[model samples]
Target: MSPPLRNDRQLSELNTPQRNRYFYGKLMDVLHFDLEQEYLIAEQRRGNRLLLGPGVVCGLQVTVIRSGGERGLRVGPGLAIDGWGRRILVPDEFELLPLRLTDEDGVPAPDDDGPLPRQLILSLCYRECRSGFEPALVPDPLCDGPAHSEAGRWVETYALHVHEGTAGDVVRECMPELGELLHKGRIQEALCLLAADCPELPADPCVVLANVAVGPRGALTITDCLPRPVAPTNRMLLQLLICLNERIEECCRHDTVLLKVGAVRLLMGNGPDAVLDSPDERRVIPRGREPLGFEAEFTGAPVDQASVVMDSSVEVLRDRTPVTLPVAWPAPQRLRCAVRNALEPGAYTVTLRGEGPAITSAAQPPDDAEPLDGEAGRQWPSGDGTPGGNFVFSFQVDR
Candidate 1:
């Protein structure tokens, strides 16, 4: 009988040539990225792209040990890559240490006057890529389809020469079965093994971080991380697929942009605060008096015909009840409110939720508009980059 099929291979075989041209074209044209790095951070200063690769590059000064599963990994001070920043982070706990020199017997050896040269193999596997953000463009079969394409293949032996730790420092090694499962593109299975292990040793062939390549059909480039399944391991993989698609949508839709509130201001009269002295400071307002004023400013992506909504509420600390605030936008994206009629005496927390129109080009219908047959539904704008976020202020209203 034949051996059972692996997930990676099974997926690759399922690829069809269905085109997702709209999203694919936007990603290709709007963003400039490299097919090598795990994530690309556009550098405003140099106009050059910085590559944030996966795995730690330990040099000849520190020692790294398997810290145990999901708890935290340990590294001696040196140079290390920031997973989110996609850049080199400095010395200390988050830093990468130098590689330990070792002798043939797997003992730590004295470092020679210079850095030692060693050849190491780095294994990598392709995960999955999602399509771009055009609501009109249907999901691409080449990428999101059930089958994987050539991109799913593995780079079993990526060779590199560098100073690294000797075998002795590796208190625990990755499970052989774990590597085998991943080698065959059994991602979920490998994650199960990783989660089951106590001290998570470095899973061989960890996920690649910065490399993303465009497919022949203009789909966004994607490469999967090696199996290091932890709690969010599965979630991380799924999010990557979503990110690849959303990024494209973000590129094309400039009319609808997100608005973010960094802080909230309180003014005595019901008017916009020219300069809020203490944003976080809460003041006492008499129960029977003129309405107190509140203001919030925003900064985010540029947009045209942008309308913003600030949903706010004040909770009476005494009764722990919430009263909605009628906060309105005076100009474009500027939020203000006058609290007069319903001012109860007590400690309160004012929460604000800022929403902007869904991002779409002038050519597309408004998000609230109905969809046409076979056309993508309404597209909503996003906050600068985030869809929406919240801001809160605390103060007391007294008799």
Candidate 2:
């Protein structure tokens, strides 16, 4: 069975110059591309619209000529002749040739046959503002979402009107409720009304509220309700680095701290350290750099002044000032110098006794301390059983 003869009449009727122009115009509207350089040349058979190029149309004009012993298709003779003297008896061997024509010099011919460009139609839909609001700008909802161009125009007009301290009578009359709402604390509500009433109004109420809040003695707290934008913090600073280092080591893996009285075993999971050793232990000092102006006030009677010895080399001012001391004579006080330029970042135990005010012994577990587990962990204690009047240590560097 042979395929049906290919006819050009229907093809030509569908592909016309006028139809091609309209299709390209619609394509331009959809893509939002500049159409100045692009135009459509229709391959038309008659007056009706047909296939437009930059595209292809199949099965235009086809004729099959059967000749003796021609088993396959062949092309010969002139450029106008296709598959000359060949038989296309089988459906698989159907052959058709396309005839294409273009305007002179390969340029798209002018489309003056139809209505103007769709862009012109769009321009007519936009109504002009009144004389008083000569530079009024509003978002075109018909445009792509969040019309940025229209929003920018609104911002400019708003700036001008705000500086002038007057919105024209028409604007004031049309939006009396909005004006009243602006004076009140209802900025968001006012913007909603403005957007509903004026299709071209900008969408951001915060900008409008900011301009209104800047006057002398104006209630600027309204601006606080507006969104508070924030910038990222510097997480790589020295203080944060130290805190994170200790927290990761203490919590990610089990470790034990030793004191004179007993040992504390700490395990890591979520929400700070899990105290596996004792439940009574509470976090007295929060982890972070301590603020200045922290003074130790104790009610107990002060002991006699005594010279103290430190296990680690003490950092003293050039003037040889005492870094650690007992409190003032009448009050039980301990004066410990702030940790300055300390290389090791961990807790240290400073043991104090009546032997003439000295760090009688300072202790920290060895760096290669065993992990807390069966048969491998070592017991360590960090403090005396008495909790009163213990010194807390911290260090930080400014970068």
Candidate 3:
């Protein structure tokens, strides 16, 4: 017996089953796209967690449509990732996604009169159909198709406006403040941030399409039955930081503290070992020397892409008086700043903290928090109201 000539074709259409469990490999005698798709993202009922996206990647513009007697929300085209890393592409067609009027238990949606506010949500779902079972399953001899045709056994993954709610926990882990945002009825913002951060953080299969308050007599669905939203401690600390930073900027106008967001991320992933690379700037300079900068180096692994960035969370002082000096954070590894002009005779100090949690509104810093080198009378709300460790690094200039 001689070997048959090889051609490009999918073996799936050829045989129903060769041997129960053996997954025979193929070559140029061509393999179908199914094999490739399954190789990357297989349909396994049970396995390790698949961090999928229930979040939107972009453009699922939601609009409340009221066409004649019909009133429902329309979900525009968008791309949402699924538990299997599959891109559930929402087609560009207009789809009026009906509202769910009751909870999973068939209870009516809470009205404004109730203490518990109504929370409505939109979720992404996955639907699979065993396609190719139609009358066209058998191709005509004249039809221009593949070299061979397989009858039966085709799966088509569809975006079922309905959600299965099978996303892993890691989806919520990366975006710690997601629940709070959704609770605050800041659905759009939450979705946007989640989409923006998804690529950078980790693979998240859980995507909350949208959320809003339930209006009087508003219909509700089981998916809409989200847990009661509560403000996370860390989120509060971040808010405090924003508020205090605005106040400082508005009041003092001179000294600005830079929020080291990147540093915080690096600290989370790589461990917190950011330290001072250079000794404190303390030297007696000639009275008539040319203007120079006061630069300080900090040892840290390079994380941020920018060569230099401003981290305003620094307090610079020329002797006793406060002065504004833009600190250049090339990264935690090196924090440099040229002296605002020549290093005058006055003592200069650069006080900053490492990747600290969102500072809270505490009369006293946490026991583990490093004491501030600056004046005790002044308080800098630097976190999200959560109690967390603060790594203080105070560089002083003394002659």
lDDT of all predictions, in order shown?
0.36, 0.25, 0.40
lDDT score, candidate 1: 0.36
C-alpha TM-scores of all predictions: 0.26, 0.14, 0.30
Which candidate has the top score in TM-score? 3
Against the true structure, whose lDDT is highest?
A: 3
> Scored by Cα lDDT, where does model 3 land?
0.40
Ranking by lDDT: 3, 1, 2
RMSD of each candidate?
27.7, 30.4, 20.9
lDDT of 2 by residue, 1-399 (tens): 112323323333333232224553464531232222112211322211211111001111212233452211111211110111011111132221110111322122344333212110000001112122222144344553353232111111111011212211111144778778888989999868855731221222111111112223221112211222111123324566889889999888743332122222221122343222332332232334322211222212222223233432222221223244222222233333333332122332222322222222222333332111111112323333232222222222121
Candidate 3 per-residue lDDT, tens place, 33-97, comes to 44444433433211112233224445666667665644466767766554334455667745543
